[model samples]
Target: MSDRYELVLTCPKSLEGLLAEEAAGLGLAEVRAQVAAVQGLGDLETAYRLCLWSRLANRVLLVLGRFPVGNPEELYQGVQAVDWQEHLLPTGSLAVEFSGHGSGIDNTHFGALKVKDAIVDQLRRDSGQRPSVDKLSPDLRVHLRLDRGEAVLSLDLSGHSLHQRGYRLQQGAAPLKENLAAAILIRAGWPRIAAAGGALADPMCGVGTFLVEAGMMAADIAPNLRREQWGFSRWLGHVPALWTRLHGEAEARAAAGLSREPLWIRGYEADPRLIQPARNNLERAGLDAWVRIYQGELATFAPHPDKGQQGLVVCNPPYGERLGDPASLLYLYQHLGERLRSQCEGWEAAVFTGAPELGKRMGIRSHKQYALWNGALPCKLLLFKVVPEQFVTGRNEPAPSQARMIGGQLVERPPAVRTEPARLSEGGQMFANRLQKNLKQLGKWARREGIECYRLYDADMPEYALAVDLYRDWVHVQEYAPPRSIDPEKAQARLLDALAAIPQALDIDPSRVVIKRRERQAGKKQYERQDQQGRFMEVSEGGVKLLVNLTDYLDTGLFLDHRPLRLRIQKEAAGKRFLNLYCYTATATVHAAKGGARSTTSVDLSKTYLDWARRNLALNGFSEKHRLAQGDVMEWLEADRGEYELIFIDPPTFSNSKRMEGVFDVQRDHVRLLDLAMARLAKGGVLYFSNNFRKFQLDPALEQRYAVGEISAQSVDADFARNPKIHRAWRLQALQG
Candidate 1:
């Protein structure tokens, strides 16, 4: 083998430039960027150095030979012509990775097998002992790239992808790969920031990928130093002395960097389970002391006060993959932008998201956007300098101060009232006064009961037909379609008044208020999406976290009126097998799981709601034993063979989903639905059936077979006290013969 051979360092396609720059910086001669790789001329020492230090490289390869091949026969001959003995011992293990396909090589597995056979046959003929194949931890890893009847073969010198870094023992869902994380940091100018001694933070960091990567780059620590194995470590041409020298130099640099001033790198995750994994990864990377991982929600995220004033704030927020509609993700992006604008002034921000449209909702224009790929998903990295002048609003404004504490509510002076004059008609003024009165009354009750989500006003006035629901600090308004007798312009003006009054009276940002129309539905119209904004917000109820999408549908996913019923189920769910049928969003099931139910099964017809149900369960730390099934609830009930100790059935008043065989009317089908559910209930099990059909009546036949008692009065909470007819509930049990 030549002392200086052509080498190729591979990375994700969009990171070619970064890889090339890194390779050139490492002193590799003739460095050139390819489609998804960087090619250069380097000896064994250079290859070893890259394997130890290159953070953005997937693998380092030593190009062996290239040849034109039109068929497997030619492929075999081309691979066999190479001197395999020079790279691997005759008895050593080997693995072949084949990419691309052409000329009878349609199957990657078949191509790989052919290459392996050629190598084994040539080695056996030359040394009488052929190497075995070890796909995992192979002594020699061979890579073959076949493109349009041409083949290039190389010896994989990195063994596994360098992204492993040998420190991530656990990861959250949809984690950013290590190399991708490194690429994002480099693009965000993390290196320059670190050199200047600025701080870094990832508020939505999952397992601290960005934090750990940034810490390594800041400390000049080798990326792969923690790895115990490398492909070149067992190669016959390996040079131990040169490798040792580069390793010692990297170690000395790391030691010196560590002894200097610490880099203030921090990661905050809402899921506490994820915090430990990040801590473990940082510890394994020898950066535990330099990085801090905290458990906090994004709304409460702020830069550490002791850290420097400016740095990089980066995050890879969820992109509505398993969570369902993309419309629900807009709120997250909006909140992220708000947080960066309000708290991260003077810092640079980089947001990596698969959904670019959601990024636009942030209201902060990006100075730069780079098209990147997170595995197979197309993504964009939005770069921003968090400056006050760049923000569309809330810039140069001081944080709101507590003006007065009414009924335990700290009313902050709203920014809107300061900038714009309050405009209201005589009727609008009356509506605004009613809203304030309701807030004072219900807000006190909500605080006393620890209810973060509750209805403050439900169309109390005739002129202003709207329902105002409070979700923690945010407010959601639902406008009832006005009567046709009223003038359209007049009704619209009144609605504008209510919308204008809500933010000012509640002391909340207007941006936090979402408005939607509620009308009597005909069929599946209510379930159809009104928009594709995909914005979801987390809200709490009785200590359980649930997601609500205020802009996507007619409802906010949670039925504030059902809060009492959910709490009742939770209190009665201990040591019971709980079932939630027609479980829209499964908030009740989440309550049951939190209440120590042995197991919980949530069944819903819509795939969207099932995804929402899964998220709700995960948010509360429920195990996989809490199952969510998507299917027609009636069909599911007929198919279920397991018995449940407790069941909650709260079907929609009416639904005509395409997935269902027939339309469902709760008033007409309540008996059949309840019968099917009760048949699966264990003897003496309690079944709570509830519906929102204002005039619903229990069938006389159901009363004959079960001991039924009305519990509507007990099931309604203080928030829904004024609207007792909002929903009705009943307790049913099998009657002894």
Candidate 2:
């Protein structure tokens, strides 16, 4: 066998350049970086060095042979041509990994199988015994690449990926991979900091992945030093003396590095559960003496290293992929930036996050950003210099305090009121002035009535057609789709102006404002999801907690305009069987339960909405006794035999859901829907029916069957008094004879 070899190093796609630089430093020659890999030439010792040293590489491949393949027979012939006896014994085990496909080999699995069969058949003919396939571990691992009808086969030299590191047996919900963590630290210039004898801290460390990786890198420790298994460990061509010599040198270097005075490394985790695991990881890496971990929170995050020491503050905060919404995470990032600026004024910082938009909200400008991948998701490594001038928000002021809720009542606003934003135009200033005037008038009543969510403004001006509503501290803005006659550019400019004026005028952060376009809907389009963020927050209405997701659907789970109706349902539902039909999120059912209803049944056509309703019910101590049924409301009403004394129906204007038998229009189907609903209404019980269709007309024939009286005037609340046409309501009951 030749002492020299051609090698390939593969990494995450965007890390090829970094990998090339690393391989060159590890004594490889002719290093050339490709899309997701680097190619180079190296001797056996150089290849072994790369395996033990590379932090960005996922695998290392030592080329065995390269040949042109045109068909399956050629593929088999080429593989069989290689002397398999040189790599593995006839009684040993092997694993084959194949990638890319062509030349009549359409499936990667089939190609891999073919290669395995060729090697096994060749060995069987020679010794009457064949090697078995062991995917997890084997005497040999082979990788075949077919590109443009050419095949290149190689033996994996790194065995399992070098990222395992053997220290992280327990991790948080979403921990960064060890190799990816190393790549991030390198890009953030952690090596330079450590060489200068500086400190490193992670305020949001989870299971100490970052802390352990950073500690190992700073101490000049080989990442895979603890690995016991390797692809070449049992290979037939293995050089035991050469491997032993290299391993001994690495051991000497590590011992010398670890014996010296340690660097200042610390990690803080909010979860106490993660603190022990993080310490375990540090201890396992033999780095427990060098690094320290404490249970702490973001608001009080502080790293008080030696007075003269300065270093990098690194963290991988939650990116809203699994936990909170992107909007909710805004406060976390903003607070992180604040901490860095206030506490570590002269230190550097690096934030690795999948949500760059949230990163932009940090109020500090990033000097550099590197693209990286977290598994399949693309992410950004944001680098910043913690200097006073780098702050984007020039105002060195604390965030505005949020409104508090006590027993679902709007308690009080801050004593300080903010004026209009100086950036607003003449029209925008006027809009802002009007909103303030309305808030002053509506604020007093909302506080007294314990209404935490209400409409602050509703297109009171012709220039800006928008609806602004407040759900506790959050503001939901909906721009009414302007008529075609209006100029689109002018409309957009006015909308931007409106958005700018909101934060200053309302005394809330820009992150709390959610904007959406409002337009008419046909068929099931109205019920269609606008976005799929799945972010939900709880808001109180009449002292009851209800969940509202502003990002996921066109309408929030709770309707502000229907506040009075929900309140009315709670008042009359005591000791009665209450039924809520077309219950979008079962907000009304929650009210009825809190109002002392003996039993409650909610019916809706959407399983999604029903699931949401289940959560809403569960949020308020309600259980299976408060039933939530999934099916067509019409069909369910026809099948339901239980009688309800109090019934509320607030349905869509039109629906053509596939789950239903036929299309439904409130104008055309109200009579049939009401008849079915009224059948189950017990004597002396009242049914409340409501809709939002402005053109809807109630049938005159319904008055002859029962007592039907319009209750639209009483249903309109103070917040929606200007838009009386928002909804129409009626009270229907059995005739008293």
Question: Could you give the C-alpha RMSD of every candidate to the true structure, in order shown?
Answer: 12.7, 8.0
TM-score to native of every candidate shown: 0.63, 0.78
RMSD from true fold, candidate 1:
12.7
lDDT of each: 0.86, 0.87
Model 1, position 626: C-alpha lDDT score: 88
Instruction: Tell me model 1's lDDT, rounded to 2 decimals.
Output: 0.86
Q: Clashing pairs in model 1?
A: 326-534, 327-533, 327-534, 327-535, 328-534, 328-535, 328-536, 329-534, 329-535
Give the per-residue lDDT of model 2 (tens digit) for 139-230. Answer: 99999999999998999998988778889999899989898999999999999999999899999998999999999988888988878898
Best-fitting candidate, scored by lDDT:
2
lDDT over C-alpha atoms for residue 565 of model 1: 89
- Lowest summed lDDT across 10 adjacent residues in model 2 is found at 414-423
